[model samples]
Target: METLAFIPSPSAGEIHLGPLPLRGYALCIILGVFVAVWLGGRRWVARGGQAGTVADIAVWAVPFGLVGGRLYHVITDYQLYFGEGRNPVDAVRIWDGGLGIWGAIALGALGAWIGCRRRGIALPAYADAVAPGIVLAQALGRWGNWFNQELYGRPTDLPWALKIDPEHRPVDTPDLATYHPTFLYESLWCVGVALLVIWADRRFRLGHGRAFALYVAGYTVGRFWIEYMRVDDAHHVLGMRLNNWTAIVVFLLAVVYIVVSAKKRPGREEIVEPEAEAEPEPGTDTGGPDSADADAAPEGSSAEGSSSAKEPSEDGPGRGKPSGGKPAGDGGGDGPAGAESVAKGPEPRRKAVDGPAS
Candidate 1:
């Protein structure tokens, strides 16, 4: 029988930045953000939104997400800072890489809500437009982890395990032999989530906030498994792991909320006209061709209507061609029934009426 073997080590190269060193991590993040924004903006335009709306919303979401992510990282890993006599601000040293995904998403959505309100755009529509791009952006962003050699999982030697450098290795990593590539798994999972969202949107009548909720659900499901396999030292709560529990709870909540809300409430699309429509006055016209013709009818006439203008029956009484005109057969009223009334008024001094002897 063959004994288990460790995975081969991967090499790293850092570029100089004048006085600073530029790592692949930062470049990956930058490239990811650029591509994500470009794709999102294009989608927004295709979905009948303004061209710059997604870009404008990005200004808000990016900052909010960064701050939220930093805060989450610091709050969860405060022990690391106090251990080295470092201040709370040290935890915020984003240049050194510490960001929490959950906090990023929560505050990012908040920022998106604010952006939609600022521009008076439909929040759900914009949310749907950005959903896929956000997932793919996260996928690309995780490549930074591959660079920094962080967020790896339990040790494994199944040919594709990631090899981490000794200095960058997680404290619990047995001896930097190799570990399950949790970052790669999560990144690929994110890519799958993005594709699922895009395809689901095209396939069904998903509307309102369903797409956004699906995003949360899909991401949490992936995070649940990935978080459990992670060997990185992280906070634990109440016998169960923190992030793993978070993934489960958030997934359930999103699922319940989406299902209940979608079934219970009708969507907010503008389907019906309001009750109070415009109404023209009794004697005046509202400038529509029929209304204009309505007010132009001559008095004391019957069926003498003109081709250019015709009066509406709903106009003022004693108006239009039927206004007390000579009724023909029996009744003297000037309404539609007056055609047989033979009631003459101002046409001729005698009982003169012309029109096929009616």
Candidate 2:
């Protein structure tokens, strides 16, 4: 008998909670999302953004990401659900398994763009703030693959090799008891990538989406190697798995973006979220009551002081004569006379006969 040195897979990947079944795959994905949002929110706040912005944006991103991931998986593995003897209905059962990270990220970014537009936030700045969290989410999500007993590598006798259940074993490899734990390897690699991105972001002060680009590049580098080790059914091109080619292309593109972005803009963004404009009061101006008083005071004082001829002639002691009976700054140079005239009020006009005074 061969000596077995490996970790046993979970008997089942689900738990029943009073007729409601909770799948380990779904739980991992959900937990990863929460962690990502929590970490992203903190980073965003550090960049001078409002709290809960990441969660608000996630409302849109999450659904789009789920749908996109499912669509990519179905499209790429159409034979699994649409070919002869395949059950088409299985495609709708997303809880079972299968999610493409590339598609999820692409569509999720689109959704985030919509959210950022509505919230008046800069997408590039937000992407940088959330990059590390996104990678960590991926790391956490890989555990789901382990739970499902999928994504294993070639048979091996290593101590950390994963023990596959007879029912879950590959049909051609039914005799094999253990295999390389590709899922575990990817999970560990992703953790390392997350840390690297975080450290690089802090050290280089990466911004303008460069940090996110670095994350993509680093993740794809790990994925490229990890994908090579996975022996699952997949489409191949040029004797290589399709994902291997995708990883290579995406990695190169991400690297190019980082280089180009660093050259175009060399510093971190000063602000991530837009500053909310102070709203004007319903029945008042934004300048406040003091400003209103200042504005009206000058107009009211000027009008009252200059219109003395009209009001004083009709009612006050001035009768028809003007106030002081002399313009300001006359002889006496507006000293005592100006003060005395003001205290005594205006001078009245004298009543006179036809030609001369009677």
Candidate 3:
């Protein structure tokens, strides 16, 4: 206990402004969300999505996520909330703190789906692009509890112990003065997971929404371990209980989905350009133009042209290797005296047979 001690509390009023109040926790959250959304929008545009789509989605997603987070928090800990003279409406006081990661993601994805549908965009692509943003937002949100001096772990004498006010510590934990900084652990862990998802997304060309699933699985791995250390009272079911089991089960499912989906994707590697594709040069050999033409052509014309163009390959008169660089009977010098092949002609073959090597 004597080895190292640095106060965990920052100046209380450092985040205040006269009568108006602004908690550092809320500031961090806003900043985190802003940054995440901006980054996600940049990524979405890079991945061939329409501009402003992410922002549009955020309009819906943020509120839904917040409400879902509040509901999850309240539902899980209703006993404390309902007991004593607690008003039912106090559950709506999300600013006071309490968010559930599971609910936030579940409802947030729904919002994204709605946004994508409105924009006429594919769902998995947007999910993949925004996965990193979600990770960063979670990392920042965890700090909100940190600023509130809550969500610490069991009391400890470890070097990095967090200084908690007496009221913040769990009742059963003997040492009220010091506890683990679970917030910092989770925050840092989230950063690592975000980077992992970014790397895997670029490196392996994870298909469909596999990258997002990886994010889920990776976050779950860390959350499972970290959840074990949370001293916050929670409802328990099964051996380890609460988030621990949820994390494990969810993580396993995510992993299974990632593995199965990745395996099913075409093995030919793909790349995400993160930018709108440029218009192609006219008459270029790329199939894009021909494909567009095929799509635009009338059905009968397209079919007839396709048949005529492809018929040469199926043993047409001129299909085989040209005899002497001309069609078999074209009005060119086919001066073939016998069966032999040469760039110039069969003349060389005839001369070779007629003369000896000199």
Candidate 4:
């Protein structure tokens, strides 16, 4: 049968620019990372997290995710990189394309955990904020597979089939020209997953990582079916591909987490970053050292006068009047101590407000 139309694979995966080679696969991955960080940062800020926190955390998560993805691909498909005829060094060439989403997410979460802990942020809240962006990143990253002309499915003459190069075609089907575009299928599915996550998160007000869990479950459901379509050589168990089994396990786990987490802690987190919480109202007594000092002052004595006497002049030899004209102990001045006092102003405390019960 003559093919009417189909997607054409790229003739070359890399381009040269002044002796520097830029791989399409690498470009896609890089673009995906930037997009993820941008979107995640917005979501995080909306959730009361500090702006740019997602990008800061991405510094740790991205590298760990890349390494984990490459390791997973090499380990699972050892025959492609190991043995007498294969080159072990090729395994490190990630730009050539090959990444396992499973390993990338697993290790990426570990990296995010480390980043979150350093920032004194909760991992679940961070995950919830970035869930949609992560899946969107996967959607963009799947284009890498399209550029490399790998991971196509069984031969088909469908209009949307992918035309594989003769050299890239499976040895057993050298005569076949077109095959199912599993990469496109997965990419489109990931996009849908991202949309679903965003909608569900808003509609249900998912929290405690439940938004991330929803994305995981939704992606796995698509992966289970998409993985079945692929003809690429992969380990099989009980007549099903290894990834199929993985999808099943991961889907179940995600669902369990969503249900249990909702029961334990329902609704979204009121405060994503403790440090970003609103400070006590101005002139409101915070019960800090300053407040304690004011309470202990004599009944007729002025608290400000007593504080000025106890606090040293930040500028010169005067206590109540400084060279800057600002009163002493008022947390204003160019001096180091005054600057320190201003910078370390009372730590903000979260106001308690009960969330609706699940």
TM-score of each: 0.70, 0.80, 0.72, 0.80
Cα deviation of 21, candidate 3, in Å: 0.6
Worst 10 residues of 1 by lDDT: 268-277
Give one clash count per candidate, in the order shown.
9, 0, 2, 0
Judge candidate 3 at residue 18 and give its lDDT.
Answer: 82
Model 4 agreement with the true structure over 1-358: per-residue lDDT tens digits: 4599999998898867889998989988998998899989999998888888899899989999998999889999999999999999999999999999999999999999999999999999999888888988899998998889999999999999999999999999999999999989999999999999889988999999999999999999999999988989999999999999999999999999998998999899899998778556688777999778767865544456554444443444633445766443334445888667545533210000111224
Which residues of candidate 2, in runs, are more than 4 Å off?
Answer: 1-4, 276-358
What lDDT is reached at residue 243 by model 3? 81
Better of 3 and 4 by lDDT: 4
Error of 3 at 123 (Å): 1.6
- The better-scoring model by lDDT among 1 and 4 is 4
Q: Which digits, one per residue and each the tens of the lDDT, describe model 3 over residues 178-230?
A: 77888888989999989998898778776588878989998998888887887
Residue range 1-358, candidate 1, lDDT tens digits:
1216544434664557798877766666677677778878886766556667788988888889878887888888888677666676677567667788888888987888898788776677777777888888788878777777778887776677887777877665547557888888999999999888888877764667677778889999999888888887888888667888888888998899778867875453331112212334487655877655545654433223442122223344543344446433323344556553334333421123233333
Q: All predictions: root-mean-square deviation over Cα?
A: 10.1, 8.1, 12.1, 13.0
Report the alpha-carbon TM-score of model 3 versus the true structure: 0.72
Task: State the C-alpha lDDT per candidate.
Answer: 0.70, 0.81, 0.72, 0.85
Q: After superposition, how far is residue 51 of candidate 1 from its true place, in Å?
A: 0.9
